[model samples]
Target: MTHHILKATKENVHLGGFSHLLEPALTIDSGDTIDVETYTGYYVYDKAPPEFLTPEFVDICQNLPPERKIAAGPHLLTGPIYVKDAEPGDVLEVILEAIAPSLPVGFNAIRTGWGALPQQFPQPALRFVRLDLVHNIAEFPPDSGIKIPLKPFFGILGVATPETARTSIPPGCYGGNIDNRELQTGSRVFLPIFVSGGLFSIGDGHSAQGDGEVNVTAIETSMNGRIILKLRKDLQLSTPVAETSTDIITMGFAQTLDAALEMAVKNMIDFLERFVNLSAEDAYVLCSLAVNFRITQVVNSPQKGVHGMLPKSIFSHKINL
Candidate 1:
């Protein structure tokens, strides 16, 4: 079947979270999927400065308005593309098809307060890298001058919060600002439907990033992507879950390592319970027996969120393609 296409330009609406700009409310049928094509969070900054080897340039670029900025906004969600029969207690499965970069946007390296390794290198700085998508490599022209492998991820994706408006910069259960790098293509992301039609949006696409994206930036770029959304009408999930062909991924967040782990465990427990329709006890046992948790980050302050996963084989079923 042909997928419905929606293209967002610099004009039209708030570029906050990607889900805010969904199309006219349309009810989604069970098993039906919507494929969305997106622009780089940079939205319209067609070219990036090739010599972003200092924090000064990054500061200048980041301060520009959305239209003039070189990187994408904090949020770039698409639509409240309404799912017809969706309701609370249902789960929305976002099958990530691809999240490759549309261009080699620049990377920003901050000084003191921004990096996980800030103290180790007590100087403030910024640098830009050109990405080679085909080779999955990044070129840093600075002193180190070494190329690095690229891992692309969507830094944010979520429905509107059930509570008051939250800043798009922080990662929370509502799926905002979660910089989990494994949320790459071919991964299945599961989020609970908090409101009607599961109003969803996604943007803040990154060309490449490290865990925690600690430097407060990545190879931020915008690109088109296709996501298949499945409506799980009978289940409720507290946090998000991702399944790859080889792994079952869980996410955790907290103010501390312990809290992040707790969040991760709760998230996994929620996944097991709702995905398999198991009771609480059974789900916990399933997590212990078949799940392996992976730490996604430990540097997000105020609270840190973690991500864990188990191989799909451990669950006896391959991740549905």
Candidate 2:
């Protein structure tokens, strides 16, 4: 397996949307590993202090052309990396090897009309946080003494969809903006490919975030990550699924939380039946006994998310699927 490095630059980054029309920044074969750099917060760049901004971040914010910006969304995503031989109907298995803070600072914000509690808190608020990299903690407020442990992950890890232009704000079958805290290091995300070459992109780095991301933002920051891409023609999946060492995660996104939950549960049942060779009835029973459905995020308006996590330990034998 070859190792490649992708830098977050104005030429390589796409602001706010995904499309098959975007040219691939880099092309690599299946089983290739990429050490990718990602930037965050296109709209909040001006609000960040000069001292906290990295040279790369500043360059991207200043030099990116206006036309590159997608008005419907706010994330600054890196790449539409072409995975060689990855075709439509195939699955791209992205193995997240490692993730780290690329900058010492991050930001969290609550906009006037955004977040889960917008009516109650109408005013906009932004907080700049410093990361104590040595301690693996975020020194929130500098003097508040509230040091939150960093659990960094990319909020967007997705491939191009069938649509020519898709907003980066919501998580969908292609897996954009999935704010699941559970997808940390040593996790594998399986995305169903739509367009050929599986034009993959990554962005919206979060140093730390809660389950629901209730306030509309996390500790948004630049991140450095290493991931291995493998083509899986053997697996036929319609939506994104993930797995860590202990749990298998099936995600669903919809207009309402109840609909998203139902989709997640049904997907989990589908997974158990297809991979574990269990009957539909048995899988439904197993879901009630072992699956824990969680609200992944609520702030990605009109597209809330739910994820069902089934513990791998429940099965006594090995599950290769």
Candidate 3:
């Protein structure tokens, strides 16, 4: 079968939140793979050379309609693709295949009130970064021009939120904006089937980002990547699980550390309930036995967030069926 490909554009849908436009019935046949071209997290802004901040910057930014700011809000997703035969009781496995640069050029910005360090830094900064995927490095000025290793990842990937009109800013059971870095190539991302075909979409590609993304931005860029969808016909996972090149991870995000942990843990509980057939209390014990929580950011607006992981080896029994 021909590989299915989708081009994301501003006209077909809004720049950042394209997943909102997906029809739940969109189908991906078994063994079918897809290539998605994603824009920078700022949408088309990456196409221009870096523009220095000025009073006009804030004026131009603030003058934008509230919804137009940030090119759309945090964590824009691009798909709710239905995996044929996937059902509410089954887990959907998405295998990341290739992740490459869509735009050879990449840029990220820090407006006065944006980012985790905004208050502490209190200065606006604009920068041009190179994500030479050929070299797998992102360069910046340290004491001088310096290059950093690239660890690319998606800032958003999730099933449609349980709430039909939900804002994509928050991370929840259905996996919106979780911001975990481990969802890289060679990883298997398993998500719950809230609606049929386990609608799945992924976007908001980042070239490199520090944990917590404290600056409220990362080496955000456009990318072209491919993923193959497979279904767990009878089994299901409550939250999302990813088996990366180096580890297996489960994730959660929330407005507070405690609440973040709750979401993370609850997600694992749901996984255990579906996969291991454990009761709520047993799932709790299983999570305690298998999960480790990792904080992604403690400073993003509205609330902080965390991501949890359980190594694939944590469970002695082979998890693959």
lDDT of each: 0.62, 0.90, 0.64
Runs of candidate 3 with Cα error greater than 4 angstroms are: 10-14, 18-26, 41-47, 50-77, 86-89, 142-145, 162-164, 266-292, 299-303, 313-316
RMSD (Å) of each candidate, 1 decimal: 5.7, 1.2, 5.7
Q: How well does candidate 2 score on lDDT at residue 286?
A: 95
Question: What C-alpha lDDT, on a 0 to 100 scale, does residue 157 get in candidate 2?
Answer: 93
Question: How many residue pairs of model 1 clash at the backbone?
Answer: 30
RMSD (Cα, Å) of model 1 = 5.7
User: Quick one: best lDDT, which candidate?
Assistant: 2
Which residue runs of candidate 1 sit more than 4 Å off their true CA positions?
11-13, 17-35, 39-47, 50-73, 109-112, 117-125, 141-145, 269-291, 299-301, 315-321
- By lDDT, the candidates rank as 2, 3, 1
User: Is candidate 1 or 2 superior in TM-score?
Assistant: 2
Model 3 agreement with the true structure over 173-252: per-residue lDDT tens digits: 66656667677777777777776666676777877877787776777766678888877775556566777765556666
Ranking by TM-score: 2, 3, 1
**Model 1 C-alpha lDDT per residue in residues 199-302, reported as the tens digit of each score:** 76677677777766666667765556777777886655677767776777777777776878877878777766656567889878877787766556554455
Per-residue error at 71 for model 2, in Å? Answer: 4.6
TM-score against native, each model: 0.75, 0.97, 0.77
